[model samples]
Target: MNFLVVIPARAASTRLPGKPLLDLGGLPMVVRTARQAARSQARRVLVATDDPTIQQTVQAHHIECMLTRPDHATGTDRLAEVTRRLRLPDGDIVVNVQGDEPLIEPTLIDAVAQLLARHTEAAMATCAAPIADAEALFNPNVVKVVCGAGARALYFSRAPIPWARDALADGRKCLASGLPAWHHIGLYAYRAGFLRQFPGLPAGQLEQFESLEQLRALEQGHTILVHTVKHPPTPGIDTAEDLERVRKILAQAVTAPPG
Candidate 1:
């Protein structure tokens, strides 16, 4: 099945304003992300943004982009606007690639989209990585996912799930041996029809309480298939520190001699 990648890049980030236009190894960050998405199996990649500067930057790189409304509540809403404007077929696959993720793997993009296609019952697909460190598992900012049989997501939360009660009570402050722990990755793949329907779905108590938009789908009785990635994704840009880190990584890549 063919896939269309829609990258939502809003300029008004609270933490890192004007992020899409920020330079990453000479190219704008959004453009770098688009370039990565272009490397995927997707038939087409489009950058959706409300900022004209971002749109112009993406277009200057000769990549397709569309200016969307600035009032969109979330990135998914922005992608929905793109889907409706493009008149994408209901059966077509649409992947929501975050604009900040310049280091996102193209293969992971393909993996999530293919997972969605293979699971007819699921409305969306996402990737997760096993939590290797105790600090990450306990970090509230690190979203955790619980998956049941056949990789169907049972729940997602900011708190450590299936809590290691025994270890915690003993003040071990470490992950229990033989216990499973997974952290949520922000990437997503969705059916075009569902993408259009997402904004209309009722906000559920779990979603509102947790501030996780994906919970709305689960509350509405839609299945989300969670697949594991062999490696965790390089962190996306969110704050000033994140930007500096990515810039340094890019610089190292540029100077590294190819064997």
Candidate 2:
């Protein structure tokens, strides 16, 4: 299956202005993200942004860059614009790699792409990992995904889902035995044609309430296939603290000798 990776990068981040260009070790954050995507099996990786600075930076690294409208309401909208502008084939797969995730694993990208290829009925595919850390499961910032049989996403929420309603009263486990609670990974893969139509869909109430774009697709009755990955969720760079944490992780990885 033909696969393309589109990264949505906006310079006007309220929390961290010029976030895509922010230094991540020796490279800009967006550049780091592009490098990770390049490692994947994607046939092409393009950075979609309205900022000239981001375009220049990405182009300087010899990465493909598409200048999109600045008024895009969401990253998904930006990606839709890229798909239309490029005239990508209807059957092609486009992976939406968040520009902030510099440490995104290439294997996870491959997994989501494979899931999309295997499931013809699924319009989109994403990944999730078991929430081993109790603290992370409760973190509102860590989006959780509940998946049903055949890898269909049941729902996504910031609140702990499959809540053990009777944990206190009946002392019974909320989730069925052997069922794992999953933490949603931001990475997404979309069928090119489906992605083109995404912008026209009405935004759903749950999407607005949770501020999760994926929910819009779910509410629209689009099936999203969710794949489980064994790897721990890598932290994305969203704020100064997140940047520092990523830097530390990268530094340690660099210093460690190859096995």
Candidate 3:
């Protein structure tokens, strides 16, 4: 179960500027994410950021922080830099815990890393949860994943997949009693070796149209295992409203009487 966890905290965010520094329960957002990662069984947890302020804030709490190049196009690229800089072995596992997920479950982190370990043939592993309703199934914003044979992802899209043909035919708006669909989670676990080579993979045609990074791997013919979970953890924070929601959730947890 030994693995490394890296929280990528870029300074700039279009929706929420200075997001890594936003306050969450008295701690910076990225710091809160690092704390969650630390609670996991990871052998090592570090914050990979592009801001010195973020670096100093994380280090102040005794968390390991590495300042990476800000120009990397995607979070995956940032993770690749960490792997190369640390010289992690090919077999080592690296979990990319998004910096905005302060409430992310530690168990989920272990699960994803273990998923990759169990599926040696897979270059990457990610989580997904069942789509319970047609509303969720059809929401373009809710990325859907279809699982293929051997627990690998057949495809991922913002559009609803599997068609649910007979059940949703005739413009029906409700999901069938037992429709099979999955909501893709952003979390990912990669073999350090694969991460080093990921950035060089050509941009995928589907990836360009959908703007989903995972598609790049699928398009490149790399195997990505889909680890289905009963329920997804609280999503990452993206806007002022999301920040307040998490703050309130944390506040309630603090004030609630012990069970």
Candidate 4:
């Protein structure tokens, strides 16, 4: 299925300033992300950003970039402006790839888009992976998603969902059984029509409390299909440490002997 990819990049990241422009193996972080997105089956890929420098940098690399309003409250809002500018059809699938994920897998991007294409009842689609350890399950930074029957997403939050009542009350450091805990991946596949209406939707109480944008759709009675992957992709850059880790991984990749 053909789809459009929009990478939302902001110059002012709270944890890491000028994050999209930061270097990753000699290329800007946003540029690296766009390269990965280009590898996907997406018919077109565009970088939507608020900074002139970032737009110039992306264009310098021969990548498409759109300079959007800097006052966007969220990346999704920035993407809405892009849909309006492009005039994407209501049925067109638009995958929202986070600008920070330079290591994002192209295959996974295709998978999410394909998943959304098959689910007509859903307004949006996202990915999730099994939570491996108690530490990650407990960490609020790792967003979790609970999916009901038919892979319909019931909720998304920073809290440990599908809470193991017995395990937690027993003071055991173990993950829940029967129903596996899942880590919500930031990647998303949105219908162009839904994306355009996103900014106008009133912020949901659950979304504001947990700082998750997906909750707003749930609150508005929209169905979100959750696609589960067995293994999670490499973590995206969120802080200085994450950036350093990705650099080392790229360095190792460059030097390692090809099998």
Q: Estimate each model's TM-score.
A: 0.97, 0.93, 0.97, 0.97
Rate residue 236 of model 1 by lDDT.
Answer: 97
Report the lDDT tens digits of candidate 3 across residue range 1-259: 8999999988888999999889888999888889988899999999998889899999999999999998999999999999999999998999999999999999999999998999888999999999888899889999999998888999999988888778877888777777678999999999999999999999988999999999999999999998898876798898889989999999999999999
lDDT of 2 at 194: 97
- The 0-to-1 C-alpha lDDT of every candidate, in the order given, reads 0.92, 0.88, 0.92, 0.92
Candidate 2 whole-model C-alpha lDDT, 0 to 1 = 0.88
Candidate 1: segments with Cα more than 4 A from true spot? 170-172
For each candidate, C-alpha RMSD in Å?
1.1, 2.2, 1.0, 1.1
> Model 3, poorest ten-residue lDDT window?
172-181
Give the per-residue Cα lDDT of candidate 2 at 46. 93
Kindly report which residue stretches of model 3 are placed more than 4 angstroms away from their true locations once superposed: none
- Residue-by-residue lDDT tens digits, candidate 2, 85-153: 889887789999999999998878988998999888889999888887656667889899999999999
Candidate 3 residue 180 C-alpha distance from true site, Å: 1.2
Candidate rank order under TM-score:
3, 1, 4, 2
Tens digits of lDDT, candidate 4, 1-259: 7999999998886899999999999999999999999999999999999999889999999999999998998899999999999999999999999999999999999999999999877899999999998888889999999999999999988888888988888577677666579999988999999999988999989999999989999999999998899999999999999999999999999999999
Distance from true position, residue 63, model 3, in Å? 0.6
Pairs of colliding residues, candidate 2: none
Model 3, residue 182: what's the lDDT?
A: 92
lDDT per residue, candidate 1, 208-244, as tens digits? Answer: 9999999999999999999897678899999999999
